[model samples]
Target: MRSARRQYLLESALMTNPLHTFQAWLDDAKRHGVHEPTAMALGTVDEHNHPSVRMVLLKHADEQGFVFYTNTESPKAMDLDHCPFASLCFYWNPPGRQVRVNGRVELVSIEEADAYFNSRPYLSRIGARASRQSQPLDGYAELERAVASEMLRYPRGHVPRPKNWTGYRVIPQMIELWKERPFRLHERLQYTRTGNHWTEQELFP
Candidate 1:
């Protein structure tokens, strides 16, 4: 029964335009009440080839790729500087669906970063200015003092985007979609990019 379900999913899967297909699945996940549907696990490697993974919100996704923002001094940013490759995974348990992406990371344009930063809430803008991300914090009081100081400096609508806070875009080279079945049987479909087009193939689960 489970194997039949898996086979049906494989036969019905979309095999072109992985980006559009991903967006459709994401929309379904959202409609299914998946918590934090845009949240994904990002994996990066350091200069020593040691891997690190963390959860980050997906800011944007389209034909170009996925985008996420962070402080330039953060550990993830440092890892990106040393190595430009990254992998992202999105799982929606309610729908028994997962998407995996492997890509090259690049910094977004200054204009793009500034626009997104300005769209953020005023307090978030101030917090971005106050916090030195990935740095060791002295204490809770110290952070409070910093936030207070920033609040006084920026007032209400005058907070500007921090120089070191920016966005990164992951330009995907490969994308894989997985669907879980009733039993252990699963369906896996992979799409690999070649120049301007993508080639799709099924993989053994």
Candidate 2:
């Protein structure tokens, strides 16, 4: 039934705007009570050309592009430093929609970072500061100590965003959306940005 409805939407109107369609899919995911609807797979390549991928939450999305926060000291950070390009994939089960985005990454504004950091849970804020992120630690005790130290340093309701804790925006050059269909057949649609305009194409699946 879900696939049938989606197939009708795909065949009839198709999406005119990928961003709008992406947002619609996201809304559908939330409505279906899907867990971690914001989660996306972030793909990056280091200077050595080795590829790495990890899951990251989608913090914000707009005409500017997709935004996600991270610790700048992590391996993914180094990869982005060497190569600014990134690919992102988001999948939702009940809605059975997936979105792929390829883009160049840029640091988000300090103001945006500060606001988002402040909005995080108190413990999450402390955890962001406590973890060295990709650095070797002595043991689990060391991690606990670090967390305790951070709590004492910030106290409750006073955790501040670290300088290394920042956000990045992926300015998309291409966006492809996939909708699951009956059997093994699937539906794929792509949008390529040309100047300020976008060109859309349906793909074979």
Candidate 3:
């Protein structure tokens, strides 16, 4: 019964602009206190064409692209440098919805990254400085020491965004939205981007 009602609502939304429907769904998730509402699994390929995936927080999204922040020198960023193609998968289990995006990734303008960085909490800015993501940690004590050192350096005043940390925007070529339904059925809507327009189609599941 619940799944049926959700399916009905989702189908109605998808009948309209699927992008609008997705933003509405994401807004609902944010309002309903879904932790990490914009968190998505990012998939990318390295130089040798090996696939890798990791959870990344979505910082921005619009008709233009989907954006996330990361250290520019990180392994993922290095992979993105080599191969700009990537994918994002967002699953909201409580809402029984999933959104998939496949696209070419690009670094957002430095100004844009700076503005977003300025908006982040001071501690987060400091934390960004302390973390060397994906690097093998010597120990918890070592991490704490780094944090303490950074905190002392910043001293509750303004924290500058690290030069290495910035944002990447994924310009989608394909976007797919799915909603679970009863009796093993599901509603799937896909949008394929071509030039300035997007073509929408429904898929059987």
Q: Among these predicted structures, which one has the highest lDDT?
A: 2
What is the C-alpha lDDT profile of model 3 across 1-205, one tens digit per residue? 2345445647555344556777988987787778899999999899999999999999889887999999888899999999999999998866788999999998899899889988998888888999998799998998889889999999986788888999999998898988777886988878898886878776887
Candidate 1 RMSD to the correct structure? 3.0
Candidate 3, pairs of clashing residues: none
What's the true lDDT of residue 194 in model 2? 81
Q: Tell me the tens digit of each residue's lDDT in model 2 across 52-103.
A: 9999999999999999999998999999999999999999999888999999
The C-alpha TM-scores of every prediction are: 0.93, 0.92, 0.90
lDDT tens digits, residues 1-205, model 1?
Answer: 2355444664565336889879988998999999999999999999999999999999999888999999999999999999999999999988889999999999999999999999999989989999998788999898899999999998897678888899999999999989887677788888899887998777777
Q: By TM-score, highest first, what's the ranking?
A: 1, 2, 3
Q: For model 3, give the 10-residue run with minimal summed lDDT.
A: 1-10
In candidate 1, position 197 carries an lDDT of 98
Better of 1 and 2 by lDDT: 2
TM-score of decoy 2: 0.92
Task: Name the 10 consecutive residues with the lowest summed lDDT in model 1.
Answer: 1-10
Candidate 1 displacement at residue 171 in angstroms: 0.2
In terms of TM-score, which candidate is stronger, 2 or 3? 2
Error of 1 at 136 (Å): 1.1
Candidate 1 pairs with clashing backbones: none
